[model samples]
Target: MRDPAMIETVAVIGLGTIGTGWVARFAAAGLAVRAFDPDAAQREALPEAIRQVLRDGGHGEAAEALRLSLHDTLEEAVSGADFIQENVPERQAIKADVLGRLDRAAPVDVIISTSTSGLMLGQFQEALSAPERTVVGHPFHPVYLMPLVEVVPGPRTAPEAADAAARFYERVGHVAVTLQKEAPGHLVNRLQAALWREAVACVEDGIASVEQVDKAVVNCLGPRWSVVGPHMAFHLGGGKGGLRHFVEQLGPGIQKRWNEFRTPDLAAMTDTLVRGVEEEAGGRDLNTLQRERDRKLSALLAHLAG
Candidate 1:
């Protein structure tokens, strides 16, 4: 269980797509939320969206009383909050300003966390007075459902703060992995980028259609991933020999494949990706695509649960 000190009122800054969902997740876990978005109009829709998800997740009546105090200013948002989660634009300058503002405005004891997908935690930490309290709490999109939250501490970050944030996440039904070093994309995104690189190369080579590539993952690796991670999967695949033995035997083949694989510069492949999405889901409404993704993700979560 998480220490009570780390799991209290959570103030979420910037109510964009990811931020709104974060609000839902934290609020549903029964934490009082104080949220802010510079664009006042965006704050209007948050209540319904959060309530809808809570209803879907079967929170029902309690969802109605879920008090999300939408604030007009960042100062109001962080006032008296135990933890502050920044989900602002993905720019270092913007983050620096926000961190600076938060450091000056919020109480020094509050845990300051960011929802940056790939940005270095150190950059934002430098702007804060108490840099040691800043933590990188990166969560995937649709934060309510995805269980993974990478908890990274910057160069000057206090060990106690990182552990406290991890315990807080665990208390609210999240799995937190503390990264030992600050790196671009952290852990999962590195693995994701490696696969995405190959995926782009495959598309450029015309080896697999977009749908076919997605099908390959969904039908093959997806199910297995639900049971175990990539390393453990291959470990089991080696039978009695296990990973070390299998790697030794197949190291040459793996090297050969790596050399044979085409490498396309990712920036140059953005249009290719846009086209691939158009080809795979061209006419589908975004809601329909979301429904499909939600269905598969829900099933995967259930399988993992068992």
Candidate 2:
């Protein structure tokens, strides 16, 4: 549980998909949440969205525990917040603007963790006068349910800032993976992008359809990956020799596969990919699909916990 003294109140600076997820997670942890967004429609819909996310993720009771307030201005939302989660668009300019305002308004000691998946923190932390307090708290989708939060430090970030961010995330039911050194895309995203490039290549080469690609992961890679990462999986593949033996046997093949990887021109295949994905969706609207995804994910997480 979040210590009231440390992070009882949180400010969410944007109301996009990721921002809403942060609010959902923070609220579910019984934190006092104050959110601000320029979009009137988003502001109006936020409360219900948080509720729905909580209910869908199997933490419905936490909805009652949430003490949420919406503000028209950024400053109002951040006032007295012990921690801030910035969810602005991925663009450096937009992030710089919002974070600048936050840096000016938020308490100097408060942590300003962002939701950037790829951009390194040094690119935008310039706006923060207390740059040491700003850190990357990159999270995966359905942020309320996903346990992983990548915490990366910027060029000027104090080591303690990253530590504090990790502590805050842990308190809010997340596993904070701190990077030893800041990387451009961070760890998980870089790995995902590598696989994504190849997945796109498969479709571009006409070797697999979009649906088939998804099925390939679902049937093979997905299950094993859920239980153990690729390194450990390959280690087990060595049949008791571990990673060293596996690498010795498979390094050439792995290098060969990497040599063949290429990205498809996304624009050329956009229509086909979209159509194929729609077919895979099977007439289920986004809300239905998301609810089902979260439900299954919750079950999987519960089983993993056991």
Candidate 3:
């Protein structure tokens, strides 16, 4: 396999939000990007949209340094590309089909990564000719700013492929977390789902409003987690005795809390969530909200780095 650090050209399949973010990120990192999107309007708008996002994220120089080529066909996009980032729809069949085509069109050495939010690598690579070279490179939304990109490998995937992906992600200023085994929703999303289920349940139980819950998280848990993960935080909570003493003392209470946690009825909570979100949005357009989010994220990232 080629050295991932030497990868200079990338093919981004699907120019949706995630794909566009990948494009901007790679371009900002000084890689030539070949982008493909079936939707003509999306293809036309991507360059400017990406440029604006880059600027918003304080990567204005990357926007000027951006070397992007928009393509109409998949084959054209993958031609001579060293890496391929697939951001197609999350459906299993759709990913399988797209990945199969990518495997056929790209050279065997070119690493093909899927930006699936919560799908298994094996499901998509089952039919691929070169499954070993394919891995899941799931990045969080607003990929340009988010530092995390989960690197998951299928059962048949080569170890080198996953390692290379980790290296590549780190090269582009991301925290690459390589999983030892495959699981649905990978790691972060599963943790997020767990927390979200509780948050939804809190609202369902009339314990707190959506805004209240969000504020609580942002004010407390969010900053704490950012500084130190849950395990370490709890270790500190244990005081002088650390995790072992804390667990022994608090285990029963923790278990009780866990048992009380409910599986929320999402269908029932949909309207409630929509109304709450709309109220929180307060008539701000998506672009405005997104820009503000990116700006704040950038500032937070800088502070954390310091």
Top candidate by TM-score = 3
User: Whose TM-score is higher: candidate 1's or candidate 3's?
Assistant: 3
* Candidate 2 lDDT: 0.87
Q: Which residue pairs in model 2 clash with each other?
A: none
Q: Model 3 over residues 152-213: C-alpha lDDT tens digits? A: 99997899999998899899899999999899889998999999999999999999988888
Question: Clashes per prediction?
Answer: 0, 0, 0
> Per lDDT, what order, best first?
3, 2, 1
lDDT of 3: 0.90
- Residue 46, candidate 1: how far off, in angstroms? 1.1
Could you arrange the candidates by TM-score from highest to lowest? 3, 1, 2
- What's the TM-score of each model vs. the native? 0.94, 0.93, 0.96
Query: Each model's C-alpha lDDT?
Result: 0.85, 0.87, 0.90
Q: What is the C-alpha lDDT profile of model 2 across 31-117, one tens digit per residue?
A: 999999999999999998888777766677887666899999999999989999999889978888888898899878888888888
Q: Give me the displacement of residue 62 in model 3, in angstroms.
A: 2.1
| RMSD to truth, every model | 1.9, 2.2, 1.3
| lDDT score at residue 18, model 1, on the 0-100 scale | 84
